[model samples]
Target: MIKTAILVDGAFYRKRAYTLFGDISPAERAKELSAYCHRHIKDEKEGACLYRVFYYDCPPMNKQVYHPLLKRAINLGQSEDYVWANDFFKELKHQRKFALRLGRLAEEQAHFNIKPDVMKKILSGVKTIDELEEKDFSLSVTQKGVDMRIGVDISSLSFKKQVDRIILISGDSDFVPAAKNARREGIDFILDPMRSPIRDDLYEHIDGIRTKAPKLEKQNVT
Candidate 1:
């Protein structure tokens, strides 16, 4: 059996899952993720054995931030998002052959920005700037070290001959460099964009493209 390692971009997977499978509980989501990875193992040629599932993400921000529209500081640690993230991480820890690799949020550089749709409405005169509310804005934060960690893991797996195939579950092209290096080291690099459209240039770096998850007919409004 061929040894296969699945690398997942946590933020990308969560967004895609929410869009395609609806808003599920943390435990359900973790199960769903494991099932998704297992599909690849089943579909591989000559049979594929699971090496590990590396999930990369940043921990939720747990600091108080001033909301300009609300005119008050909000305790992020007390928010539903923080609770959900912690619960999700806990549940992921129980998954077989799963490894959670977490990066840190750049809290000092965090700020708020108007939601894309809200900003478009304001720009098109559909809504006025004065009518903006707290809901119109979202806290924007950057994740640090996720890409570097992924690259390091890929290089390690390739150089050490740990896995015969590497499946990356992300739409980001930033992984092209790592993918190229892995392929040079004789690893079959597969890209799973979850049926999302990818650039033509990406075809050269990967051995194949595959997504086992089926798209939902009616997406949940959450």
Candidate 2:
């Protein structure tokens, strides 16, 4: 019987899950992922059993802020974002077979940058520089220690021969080296992109790719 390990990139899964599964709650999403993963394992190998599921994510960004456009003070630490994230994390942690590994967001300056379309409009005089809206600027939050943790864990598992197969649910190419090394160590690496488009080079490193299909809702009989 093959022992299978599943690694989920939480941020990627959250975003893609909404697109693929429609407007489902975070708890519902987590439940579906866990169920789907186990089913996939059983279907792939006749007697395969799940080793563990690793979930990687960062705690919600809780920062004090003021919007320049509205001249309003906002406490992100007390907002809906903060509440929902805490709830979501708690739900995942309560799952029996899940292991949650968290990374963190670094404190950085949120500099202003115009959107590409806005810049083009300014150049063409369709909109003046003064006409730019607050939406044109986006605050970029940098993630710290995520990729490092992933690489380290993969290396640790591969070297110890902990599992026969590793399935990573991520679309980022940063994992190429780790994937190659895992394959070299004779661990079958499979990728579950969950319907996202994968990079061309990623194809060469993985043994297979698969995703769980979303079920459609039935219409009410009238």
Candidate 3:
């Protein structure tokens, strides 16, 4: 029984899930997420026990508006414009839509000013000739709290010897320091990026790295 704990960033997982699959079921998502951890168990730790899965996410500020808006924002299917003969401006248009929806949500729900702040941060200093672009603000919101939660949890678990191995399912670099500290304390740390490409820096430092199997892609559960 390999003792493993999975710390998942809910927002990261949800966005990736939607990208890889049309829609994701909670049950299936949990199953897939856990299974990915199981596969990446170090060969020597065959009987390690899986301790728990910790999922961190902000409660939907406006569930009614966020989901549909995010979906539309991410999907921008454009055909090749024979007139301009350029690659479909997919990411550009998608971000524009995302920014617009974020702005709407902010206005309606008294949340962050999605449009103005997003522009200030990601789309700043763009000239009139520049093509449209989108900015990723999801990570920005999660930066302070979520990273803290993950770090504290990992440290607590390691100090208490809660599990032999701890697995994190996120691509963010903020966890690197925590993971490094965990390694220094003799707790095995593994990185699971769900479906996103795991960066070399993260991969090199972890005791193990596992990605979702191709079978997960076939499930089409999202």
Candidate 4:
């Protein structure tokens, strides 16, 4: 059997899951993620075996920051998002053959910004800036060390021959270099974008493209 390592971009998976599967409890989400990973291993054509599942993500921000729309400082640690994220991470740790690679949020650079759609409306004169509300804004923060960690792991896996196949679950082109290197080492590199459209050029870098999970109907717009 071909040993396969499944690498997940946590932010991308979470967004896609929310869009396709709607809101679910953290424990349920973890179980779903494990099932999704296992589906790839059970592919009869590849005869893949489970090596490990590496999930890369940043811990939730737990700092106090001033909200421009609210005109007050908000403690992010007390937010429901923070609580849910912690719970989700805890649940993931309990899964077999699962490895969590946590990066960190650039807390000092964290700030609230208008949502992209809201900003577009304002710029196009469809909505006035004076009409902006708290709901139109969202906290923006940069994720540090995530891409680097992924790159390093890919290099290590390739050099050490830990797995014959590397299946990355991300849509970002930033991983092109790592994927190229892994392929050079004779590892079967596959890209799983979770049904999201990828650039035409991206096909040249991977051995295959596969998404085992079925997309569910979106229940709500959040």
Candidate 5:
């Protein structure tokens, strides 16, 4: 039987899981994700044996900063969110045949900008910044080098022939070249979009698609 490997895009899976399961703890989320990966592969095995699972993401920044929402400088490292994320990583590390590939986050100076409509209302003397929601302006940080690490790993795995099939759990189109290369190397490439829509062009690179059922959106509002 051919060996199959699974690669997870941690950020994407986390967001989709929240939409599916709601505001759950990281440990619970990890548990469900682990089951999903294994179950999905087993269902799609087509006579292949499970190889290993790889998860790629950057670590939390957990830095202290003053924000418009909090109105004070706070240490994110001391926050509940950081604690949960650390715990989640630990859980994954302990899982069988699971590898965690971590990337570093780079910080930059940024300021929250007022929305265009909010600015127009202010210019017309109809509203003020304080009248708007704090969420309207958010301080943002970007992840660096994560994509490169994923691409390099894909290339390495394909070239080394560690597994005959590779299952990538991501929606990013950046993996196109690597996927094409792997296909040329006679690897059976499959994609799992977490029940998300796949692009038209992406259909050319993969052998098959599989995903868990996404929860239906609740639209009723009181």
Candidate 6:
């Protein structure tokens, strides 16, 4: 049996798992994950020791942007700072300063202006910085903490010689160096890409790669 460690990327897993299960309960998801790993592992005939599962991802910023309870659970304190930065960015866009005269030109035209009589046209379909709701999101934000967390833990696990094999669930090319280092230390490195294409270089170096989800029909979500 291969001694295995499963390190799942939170950003990758959360989005894909939601697509599969439509729910975010980690405990419920863990059972699906464990079963999935068991099926794809290369040396299952020899049995396998699942060391542990590590999931990494960031938190959401706007509560109104997601289901209320989910928002409360998933949001991090840094989200408030990011939300404030987004609001300021919108305000700056409305101000339309610098050498650019795009907004000014639009204002000079008869098609654009602020007049009480034109309020019907403006308010009917137009939206402003202050008027925008959660839908006006401009930031492509994630919790931002997951990467560091993953890196720290991976190093620790390797240094401790915790497992003979390691499976990483990510399509981000960022993990290439770490994966390479893991191999040098005698750990079998495997990549599990959940739709996001794996880098060609990464494909060349890893012991194996997994793309298809393991037998879901055999196991149902509890």
Best by TM-score: 1
**Per-residue lDDT tens digits of candidate 4, residues 1-222?**
899999999999998888767799999999999998999888748587989999999999999999998889999999999999999999999999999999999999999999999999999999997899988999999999999999999989999999999999998999999999999999999999988878999999999898975765455433
lDDT of candidate model 2 versus the reference: 0.79
Clashes of each: 0, 0, 12, 0, 0, 3
lDDT of 4 at 192: 91
TM-score of each: 0.95, 0.83, 0.57, 0.94, 0.84, 0.56
Between prediction 1 and prediction 2, the one with superior TM-score is 1
- Give the lowest summed-lDDT range of ten residues in model 2: 213-222
Model 3, range 133-183, lDDT digits (tens) per residue?
A: 333323122233666788888898888888878878787888888888889
lDDT of 5 by residue, 96-120 (tens): 8889988876654534566676778
lDDT of each: 0.93, 0.79, 0.56, 0.92, 0.78, 0.56
Write model 1 residue lDDT over 19-77, tens digit each, in one string: 87889999999999999999999987799999999999999999998888888888999
* Pairs with backbone N, CA or C atoms under 3 Å apart (clashes), candidate 1: none
The alpha-carbon lDDT assigned to residue 58 of candidate 6 equals 35
- Model 6 lDDT tens row, 1-222: 778777777556655666656763444455555555556555466777777666554333433233231233333334655454344333323321111111111111112113443445447676543553443333333344556666666667777898888888776777766777787888888888765556677776788976555334424421
> Weakest 10 consecutive residues, lDDT, candidate 3?
96-105
The superposed Cα distance between candidate 3 and the true structure at residue 40, in angstroms, equals 5.7
Cα shift from native, residue 52, model 5 (Å): 0.9
Off by over 4 Å in 1: 216-222
Off by over 4 Å in 5: 69-71, 109-128, 135-139, 218-222
- Which candidate has the highest lDDT of all? 1
How far in Å is the alpha carbon of 144 misplaced in model 5? 1.8
TM-score of 5: 0.84
Q: All candidates: CA RMSD in angstroms?
A: 2.0, 5.1, 12.9, 2.1, 3.8, 16.1
